[model samples]
Target: MKEARYFYVPNAVTETELPADEATHALRVLRLKEGDELFLIDGEGGFFRAEVALTTSKKCVYTIKQTLKQEPTWRGGIHLAIAPTKDMGRMEWLVEKATEIGFNKISFLDCKFSERKSLRVDRIEKIIISAVKQSRKGWKPVVEPMIPFHQFIDNCTSAGQKNICHCYSEISKLDFFTEANQSLEEDILVLVGPEGDFSFDEVRYAMEHGFKSVTLGESRLRTETAGLFAVMISQLARRV
Candidate 1:
């Protein structure tokens, strides 16, 4: 049997046809017609086996034939918070790889040394949606806009398994893999600094607010690389 085409559709329970963008792709690009088989990913851990019921100039109406509740590959959520690189293309690549590797959320940080000030998350979200479908992931990762470093740390005070990857020789640090391995079934959040690295004050503040200082490794990594590494470690740790 031929594989079914997968489309990301959110809140499609009561909806009849694909959204404007998805519809255009289905109609013009894929040339999907009535009676074609498709899989709808709701981005909420739901996989619906559906049949094309009807097709209009810009619509792909579908009737769900089966509902599959597939479990995520990893055990708990992995939230990667990083200071986005000045070159957004690097961040986009990181987000794509991290999504394919498995992560739940990604947040941009505006650190004291951060080169990039503002970011539009809509484009990043679209990359995430595409990655979800490409990777056949059960859930879609969220892309949050950049927030001040101080505010980001403060807000995560109550988060479970909070860790920060930094290179502060004077400051005591734990290995991220070791720390993450201990909390297999808990939601983990990791903070990666910018290329310029986190300021002493910022690192100190985060440490004071329950964010454990951790090191990714001895080798220095770029901001995007650090973020992707954190996500990869979190995903691997959870599977252990």
Candidate 2:
């Protein structure tokens, strides 16, 4: 049997037409025509088997043949909240890789030392959607709007395991992997600071508010790298 082409359609259903971008890919790029079989992912844990019903230069329509629900292979959720980097490309790269690596959600932090105060949420979301389709992931990671660091901390609910990864050499910090392995909480939230790292006061505040201080490793990592490291460790912990 031929491998089915996969498309991302957030609200896919019977008789639903493919979105503009997806339609272009299906009609112009893939040259799919009526009766061609394809798969659609709604990015909310839904997989749909669809058959092309109509195709034109600018449009592609499909009818759902079957709905396939997929369960997550990994246990727990990985939520990484980090300050956006000054370079937008770096931030986009992190988002793409994190989604492919399988994380549940991502949030941006505006910290004391943050260089970038704003972000293009819409563009970043598109990157995430593309990554999801490329990785063949069933679920989509939520890209939350950028908010002040203090606001994010204060509004955080008292659930799951929370940790802050920073460059505080004086404070005793446990290896992220080690801490994650010993953690009993299934939902994990990790806070990573900006290029200059979190200020001493910010770290102290987070620690006071139930956020444990942890270290990724001895070598210093950039904001994006640290965030990805935290995600990987959190994911690995669940498998152990």
**Residue pairs in collision within model 1:** none
Candidate 1 least-lDDT 10 residues? 151-160
Per-candidate clash tally: 0, 0
Estimate every model's Cα lDDT from 0 to 1.
0.88, 0.88
**lDDT by residue (tens digit), candidate 1, 122-168:** 98988998999999876998878899999887778554898888898
Off by over 4 Å in 2: 1-3, 183-185
Question: Model 1 TM-score?
Answer: 0.97
Residue ranges of candidate 1 with Cα displaced over 4 Å: 1-3
Worst 10 residues of 2 by lDDT: 178-187
True-vs-predicted CA distance for residue 239, candidate 2, Å: 3.2
Q: TM-scores for all candidates?
A: 0.97, 0.94
Error of 1 at 222 (Å): 1.0
